[model samples]
Target: MLDSLRKAAGTWVAKLLLLLLVGSFAVWGISGQLVTGMGGNSVIVAGGTEVSATDYRLAYDRQLSVMSQQFGTRITRDQATALGIDNQVLAQLVAGAVLDEQARKLGLGVSRDRVAALTVEDPAFQGPDGRFDRNQFDYVLRQVGMRPEDYLTNREQVAVRQQIVEAVSDGLTAPDAFFRALALYEGEDRTVDFVVLPSSLVEPIEDPSADVLAKWFEDRKANYGAPEYRKISYVKLEPEDIADESAITDDQVAKDYEASKARYTTAETRRIEQLVFASEEAAQAAADSLKAGSTFDQVVAAEGKSMGDVQMGALTKDKVPDPAVAEAAFKLQANEVSPIIKGSFGPMLVRVTEITPETVKSLDDVKTEIRKALALAEANRILLDVHDSYEDARAGGDSLQDAATKLNLKVTTIDAIDRTAQRPDGTIVDDIPESAALLAAAFESEANVENDPINIGSNGFVFFEVEGITPARERMLDEVREKVVADWKVAEVAARLGAKATELEKRLKDGATLDTIAAELKLEKQTKRGLKRQADDADFGRTGVAAAFGVPEKGVGLTPAPTDGGQILFQVSEVFEPAGADASTLPEQTRTSLSQGLADDLLDQLVARLQAEYDVEVDQGAIQRALSF
Candidate 1:
């Protein structure tokens, strides 16, 4: 299993370097105490270059910053969990370390020119004209917890990794023959035609003798078992539950609406034709021409300028810059052209062809929007206050009871929630200040009341003391007798079906007709009429299509042995076998699949060699320390 796992892991290393997604590492107030794995176990491996607390902290901050930007808001615990972001962040760090070690071992280094080329050309780091824009790069960097140099270094590594990627993916080609076949398959639309005959058509059979049932039961005891089910009781706290109308007086609402009116109003916007010449004099001349009663498009064509203006709409002040030219353009009434306004590309003329004005809406027109905004604001304020008050009390070393009193929040207890399940209260928690999942870190033996506080979510933190931790135990047969009995019944039925099938096969082997067999069994010789080869699931929902396909025309055995779905009983009516496909002219589907197989094989070989070149020793102690939860 270990060797198999490694082989599978090696096959995937070609894709290992891709930075497909950024990680999330949000930080909440630490309360002056650093908890390791939920069990106080360290969450770090001890090998390689020494990893420090600062490194962890910086990486985490960067992860959170990236997440916040991607989400366009603060990262919630639920959102983090949905992304599995904490784990991704840690894995990002680990993969980087591993690749860095490999690069160092290979004596591979990124040259300064290469780094500069990458940085200057990276669209993320470039301004509109494609020149290196350090300010833009640094602005993004500051948000994600790195300095300019760190970002530059990271870009350098990315360039080196791209080199490796190019080596792996280059020279990968499918020949013309393959391409032709692939195109056909890509264009092919296979049709399937079939009729569905439900089991309700079958007449009911008489009750079986007790002895027969017992005999059938012996061969199929497993199916009679019932499913193991769980009943969970949980407390749900949604935002609307706690809100009251008393908190939102009409006056207060009117004030909020007035203060943020632009947000509530429909925006007046326009799309314009802009022509800029690299030479300022040429641009000014074009602007002057526009002011001489020439149409914008006619002037644009005359100037030999080519870039079309963007259709910017519903824009506010911040949407576009606040320069006088832009401001004047936005202020113009519909169908108006502003006077030539000079700027970087020399003078620029603008035309406004569309405009929508701000209008007051009725309460009915905006009730839902108003309600949601109010709810979100109230939720944020309440949750923030609750979080801050808890932190303050904990910092002051107040007892849990004292803290609860000071915060005016309920002091509550929980039923033991195992690692995989929800907390007794229906909170989907994450990053429990330990390792991923935090299951191993929490146990029943330590969960009973009468201990210290527990850390739950980030701001939704809970300091839980051990209440009662129950060790897991397998269910005894006696405890699940009903389930076992149900399983036994299903087994009995399936066994009987299997036996009937086997007997039919035997009789067919002795040269009995399908019609004769059906007659002997008092069953109809029903068949699918004019069925297509690739019938859909709804068409094949009936049981007998598979059986019809499985019977052999020449012999007693199943024909062709194709399990389109499940057991087909086929007999050859007549041979209408498809012509042997031309390997050279096979459809695009087959050729593309073959190409992918080849590429995968090459990747497999490269990864195998790479792994052979490195020495990896897992420190069991360190791994356990990091993943104890």
Candidate 2:
């Protein structure tokens, strides 16, 4: 539970796991066993275990908190719903409940003493003394709103689930053939001889008749069509626009500096290392020896373990896992070892390795930062009033220009902007406020609809209305005569190119060499060597590289040129197949890759078996109700 809590508080990904554990406790209760649903409180039922609504809510909140921190934005309930965060959280909790049910059925569980020991080892509940402090522990529980019993019980479940995972992944190894095949496949290379035939290589055709151009345009009218474009006007409200730096006086900065003194003051922290024992008597004996002038190395050696095995990294008192060890550790001077202290794991000995003294920055040093923060806070408050005023005026059916005039903001308009923010002439539309959101709202709304103010990144909102719209229509032949002529010529060239390549392929099959053909056509034949399937060869392009590998040795092929607007006629000159090497002679990277693949396979199989064994039931209605907020 300690590890999970620590991870949950620190990372976005780990928060999901943390919430699942919290939810499992509420649904499963504190019996150290799986239980059926108690009335409608259960939101999920996997096998015999049930997940309660209280647990679901706790998990969702934690998950949302981590997401908000990770994204650096306060995600609203509507946004969370749009992102399907609630469904994702529910799925995670259900999966966790399934795993818990399986672990219990197998009689795999962690002992209370072991859970306690691990909990105490966590660094979060430690006091400044580098040991677990009961008061600090209680305070942390209160902060997270967790009962001590619930936390401990959740930790035990985590341990049991971990045991099952470890057992499934143990001793897994990939076959030698699998590794050899993958390595060789990745290393294989090919060479090709080819000639590029761009549309320019073909003789230019004469201009077609008006009738021919019209027919050509009619054949491919979609290419010469225009997209529906919208004309819109908007008022963008941003916090910075409303901020008054002059209003942030020296007095305000000083008060802010005083109020947030803790931010400027660095706390004294101690670095401590600890060794946990399985029994209190054994731990006491080791501590007595250490206190009597024996070295930690000597004590570790006596316990038949290496000193390196017990090195918990340096942490502040509150960061330490066990309260008792933290208290004893902080009381010791640098390089001093503590006697046996009752640890959650059992008996433990702690040593203070180093201490960092506290320091505080004076007001002058942080005044600039404080002033900026205070001004920003004031700006945020001002933006709220600005947003409300803008909404009220718009709701009263005032024009965008009128609303902007009343609110003292500028209204910007675009004559025409498509969904992709491009004009009919292909030039991108610019100088629009909150362009992406503005475009989205414009395109999504009908003409004259006033859109709700959209929340912009951290600082602003954009309210927009579609002024007018132009429906898409195909271009007339005369309107796009130049483009139609170009398309006709391109079609003629492509047809000739394809036919010529086919004839060349036939000639190659009839025993003609590429050198002779290139000489006859007065074209240069380029040669590419040692190209891998994954390589990006400018001469061959991606398609040419794939074609080179796809062709048989000395076989000819044709592929379209990627960007130069032509086709490539190529012949494979050589191929390098991967050598089959034994697994032992392979590189460390190869071995690691094979090992990971084998482990993934084992885990997949484990999950499949668990799914087959468990009867999973989800309350879709309950999930919907919970996420409706």
Candidate 3:
């Protein structure tokens, strides 16, 4: 019951309820506290419905607990405030109060019998026998810190509010026009004729003069700036690093092998085929035919069945399921048939097509494996001790390297690496423990600050310290001349290609054939038919497809190629609408999705109306006091 509640709390409905009930109490400053001096314990008041501070605190703590479980750590009060848990809890309370008030105005009430029925029908209250259990109900409510009467009251209120929600959103469906428009938009297809203009088609670009190159470098110096790098030293402690296979004695291996002998044993199995008959006389007659001259498969065919219908794949004696069949099948040799026997289902003839003998590995065969397993187990058992020893040395004011050396652990030093773990030469630094986490911590840490160790799950821990920092700086033209020249050439090629594609598009618009343009440029002309609006072609690319769809039939446009700086000159040849199928024929999933969207919109509007009608008031001061602890 407790587990079910925890799982239920993670669902979307639970999350939405939390968000709605937890009003913006933290954001509602004392100045906006509408019920500030109302006194008493009420934190929120909607019409005649009031939420006490005790109730608000209970909801806040419940939400906090759920968040803590999700994050796998305890959430502090300050963290909860930062996450707006207080606001969400208060908002939910406010929304519920408003709904309750409106329900009261509408004279909406749930009978005690109805609440009782809902309680009894709840799956969380079911016992192992699948019936409502009073003990389970009491236990689950106690675990969640709710009293019986309080739970019943909350259940009754929820039932009442549900009445309004159902009236507002039930039986809603997406309009036919909206569905048809969506179907048309999603199912439209197009075909296009396009030519890719490569950079080679552009006129040759000469090397820039020294002055021109220098000016270009100056304009884009920031692009060539070197990233900030940090030099760090770290020590890693893992079980594999400390495990010593040689330390595991033969006697220990023998003992472990004895304790887990079943791990090395393989069960015998056989490929058995069966032919069951209505009576012993029929099965005997089939066996006689098989023994005379007919093959098992021929006999099966005579019975209007194939081998697949009779062959039971490999099975161990215990896996045969029928005890009589299992005993008879195991007694026969390969290719040998058993006498007609009565199985659980009927009288059947069994044939053993293949047999696998059981095998057990000797202690000598698995001695080394057992030794390694024992060694790893011992290492894991003592890993915490090694970690503590290192911490003790650190507490004694020892340096990271000194402490690691004392424990006989190696310390790795990274001379200089940027946030991306790249060296100055642009090569990625390799084999760093927890590379990403280490780099992020190294960059955020100062040289002399004592940084916390990164726990790499159960495997190990990595302790790192930033040694030195190199600030980012712009590189001189001389330092990046080769790269700058290559980039400049690319930009020049792109500019020329763009101009050429524009010329080609204008020609196509002026009635020149795509084939003629392709032939003149010595490029391939490609046509893609039945291309949907959302088609993602590798060579044509999405932007090119969009450009094609944007133009009318016979219109030409250009877009940059997905790869390479080349551009695509395309002419839309045809546009096809969806077939004559009506929106009512849409897949059930699509219709349900659309209907759910409409229902959600209706519910949102109803909630807004209720909130306004009730004139919700929040006691910010009361909320602050309630969550102070």
For lDDT, the strongest prediction is 3
Q: Candidate 1 overall Cα lDDT vs. reference?
A: 0.48
Error of 2 at 442 (Å): 10
The Cα local distance difference test for each model comes to 0.48, 0.75, 0.81
Decoy 1 TM-score against native? 0.38
Tens-place lDDT per residue, model 1, 1-629, is: 11222233232211111232211111111111222443322233322323333444455544454555445688765676586555554544444444445566667788988778766765665677878687877765554556767666666765664555456655665677655554443333222221221222231334555575555555544543332222212111223433445567666667666777667676555555444455767666766776687777776677665435433444554556536556877778776767666655556666666666556676556655666678666865686566566668767786655666665554544444546545534465443333232334334324323233334444234443443455445544455445445555544444555455566667766777777776665655544444433343343443433433444434333321122222223344542333333455565576666766666566445434443343322232443343323
Candidate 1: misplaced stretches above 4 Å? Answer: 1-102, 126-135, 174-498, 509-534, 537-539, 542-568, 572-605, 617-629
Per-residue CA lDDT of candidate 2, range 1-629, in tens?
Answer: 22334444564235424633542222221112233433476778777887777778777776676566556798888888886667666656765676789987887778789989977876776779889888877876665567888778777777777777667665667877877776676778887888877666576778888788878788899998888988888777887666666788998888888888999998778877778888988887887786688898788788888867877777777877888887888789988888777888877787888898778999999887887778778878788788888779877988788888987787778888798889877898776767787788778898987778777887788888899999998878777888789889878888887888888878977899888888888888988888998887787778778888787898899888777678888889888976655565578886886786677567556555555567566676665555554
RMSD of each: 18.1, 20.7, 8.2
Error of 1 at 615 (Å): 1.2
Instruction: Please list the residue runs of candidate 3 whose C-alpha ends up more than 4 Å from where it truly belongs after superposition.
Output: 1-40, 208-220, 229-416, 431-469, 499-513, 542-557
Worst 10 residues of 2 by lDDT: 24-33
lDDT of 1 at 341: 65
Q: By descending TM-score, how would the candidates be arranged?
A: 3, 2, 1
